[model samples]
Target: MSIPAFADISKSANDLLNKDFYHLSAGTIEVKSNTPNNVAFKVTGKSSHEKATSGAIEGKYADKSLGIKGRVYLLLPTCHPKKGVKLNLTFKQSAFHGRAFFDLLKGPTANVDAVIGHEGFLAGASAGYDVQKAAVTGYSAAVGYIAPQYSAAITATDNLSVFAASYHKVNSQVEAGAKATWNSKSGSAVGLEVASKYRLDPVSFAKAKINDRGVAAVSYNVLLRPGVTLGLGASFDTQKLEQATHKVGASFTFES
Candidate 1:
């Protein structure tokens, strides 16, 4: 499995379910179910002017008796030749997880990655050797620690980017975090961002962030039903002293 230069929430149900649709601009439909044998599955499709049409199917099979679990996904794009097809496979058990992944639009680029961890600490690394295959051709790794009150991580990539982030749970109602990155290859520093979230109640929360780029943003999320959620977000560009963007979206889930 090749590690992606960036993350794509659409390719995996875990990521898709975690997405904050506050700034989302597309319309999406998703269905999730489980087979009689306990194989879980999810199917999601989205449409938008910028993205056109795209869909993905993901499945997970876990054998508690065997102490192993596996997941696979296939994503289809209705437009663009390079983004038309993609596949991913992941396997996990106890302290280790492995994946064999790749994409087509580019020369045959494949990546494999592994992570070792327990409850409080984790470490992982990945590599792609062929530079001509993709602009993301390089290696990257990360290590992190988590506790009830605080968590921190450090990550670096052969692309000459290094970053560190940390978060602290100040109390039951508030949590704060910040991250900074530097790209040695670009000979410049990436923006530093500070973010925080506040729990309004058991079912609602608000989040806000400010960055070195003079951008500030905020979002609010709430549960509308047991399986439905709604979110709204807006951002302002201080440099322009104007609203940059605003969006609202909702998601629903169903399972047997």
Candidate 2:
């Protein structure tokens, strides 16, 4: 198995809890196209009751022989006149990978990350540098072990004030994972969450999760066609069910 990067250590569990859970108050549509020349394009539009309609267009190109890929994004409404564009580039090899990002719209900032893995063991770090202040804004490090059926990782971030650990496992028809975090600066209780996904069939699945806080969520996804999918999700505040503070969302995606 190939180990993932520092931030992706808990991707399996996080994706189950976060991905495809659209907000009921909002609507989104995305279109993706790929070309034979190793280039792709994506356009996304979003609207919500709380905010005005917005959209973004992205273009990407990849060179498999050189192990390099690049992407650029143009945000709708041009958040910043001087820095309205975002850029990213990445290089990947068998044992190492690195990425750089430029988001001038926010602080005119730039950041870089690198990861190295061998025999299912991984180590990596990332740092953000502020251009205006000419100072190191933040940094973190992590290590992880990945296997065919299970994976585990630990990381210290937020200038070493926050620590987190995650573990995931896959079985025949179910995948389960958990993550825990503690903030040394806050001196507060630890936070924990566990999630699981069950495969109903080859084309459909269901997921459910709960956290230390009295909140729980469930989602279902199904492939509607070769290039289309549908997703439905709902979340509830278990501590205040009588308040009717529940959310429901639906999403549809198309690709070609």
Candidate 3:
């Protein structure tokens, strides 16, 4: 669950923060099958860097593996032009929060349940998007074992059968839950950097290179829409080590 980012994506004391919206994915799909047998056509064009990923530490663009890019097994979009129904489904690696120390990596022992969920308009646009989570992720219980399929199949499965309907369970397989929670948390932190990346610049001279190091930082964000947000932020970053270049930054941002 803990995706081992190939490199430290976070800035040290004086790295740079980029303000850019990254294309997590851009793909096209043509329904090969709908309803009944339930199959469809999907084509995806992702970063060709082979090991590239969006929002990596190198900047807010495609960089090396910050962690394994979530696998894109199936991508689908649905909408009712007449009634105004909409849906979005994507499959990618969901990161985990855990660590490897003394040569041992410990984390929530659960495998990333291959996932399939939908969020869309159940009513008018005024109703906004109704999101849903339909996956089988087991957790530990006092009894020692509790399958995601246990106690509450209805809650996890959302009334529809496990492997039926437009929405289906991926059954991606489960790892032990013992450390899954922590690993997932760490991986999720990568998204929090949108808040700030504090950078302090130092005066420099070619004859004598002084402190080249910058500051590094982290922050959390919460929002109902990308167009706007309200969240907490903190950072520690340093100016470009070279001191020859300057980076432009906004503590917060809006499209306008």
Best-matching candidate per lDDT: 2
lDDT per residue, candidate 2, 1-256, as tens digits?
Answer: 5546557865765676566666453567778899999999998887764667888999999997977777777889675664356777767688887878887777778888888999988889999988888888999888888788888888889887898888889987999888899999998899998888899999999988889997898888899999888877788899999996887766777899
Off by over 4 Å in 2: 1-3, 49-52, 66-68, 82-93, 100-110, 131-134
lDDT of 2 at 3: 44
Error of 2 at 129 (Å): 2.8
Query: In candidate 1, what are the lDDT values of residues 1-256, reduced to their tens digit?
Result: 3222222101122121223534454466677888877699999876653667778999999888976677877778535443434456777667776776775545567676777667757677777644354554677777665555665666666643765444444568887767666777776767577777788999998877777987767777777777666666656677786453434444444444
Between candidates 1 and 3, the TM-score winner: 1
Which residue pairs clash within candidate 1?
1-100, 1-101, 1-111, 1-112, 2-111
Query: What are the TM-scores, per candidate, against the unseen true structure?
Result: 0.68, 0.86, 0.16
Evaluated against the true structure, the overall lDDT of model 2 is: 0.81
Runs in model 3 deviating more than 4 A are 1-36, 49-192, 195-256
The 0-to-1 C-alpha lDDT of every candidate, in the order given, reads 0.62, 0.81, 0.22
RMSD of 1: 6.1
Give the TM-score (vs. native) of candidate 3: 0.16
List the lowest-lDDT window of 10 residues for candidate 1: 8-17
Give lDDT for model 1: 0.62
Per-candidate clashes come to 5, 0, 40
In the range 1-256, model 3's lDDT, one tens digit per residue, is 2222211111111122322212112211111212232222223222321333222111112223443222224222223332322222223333321221111122212222121222211110001111232333332111011123311111112221111101111122311100111123234421111112222222110110112243333333333344343233232335654553332221222221
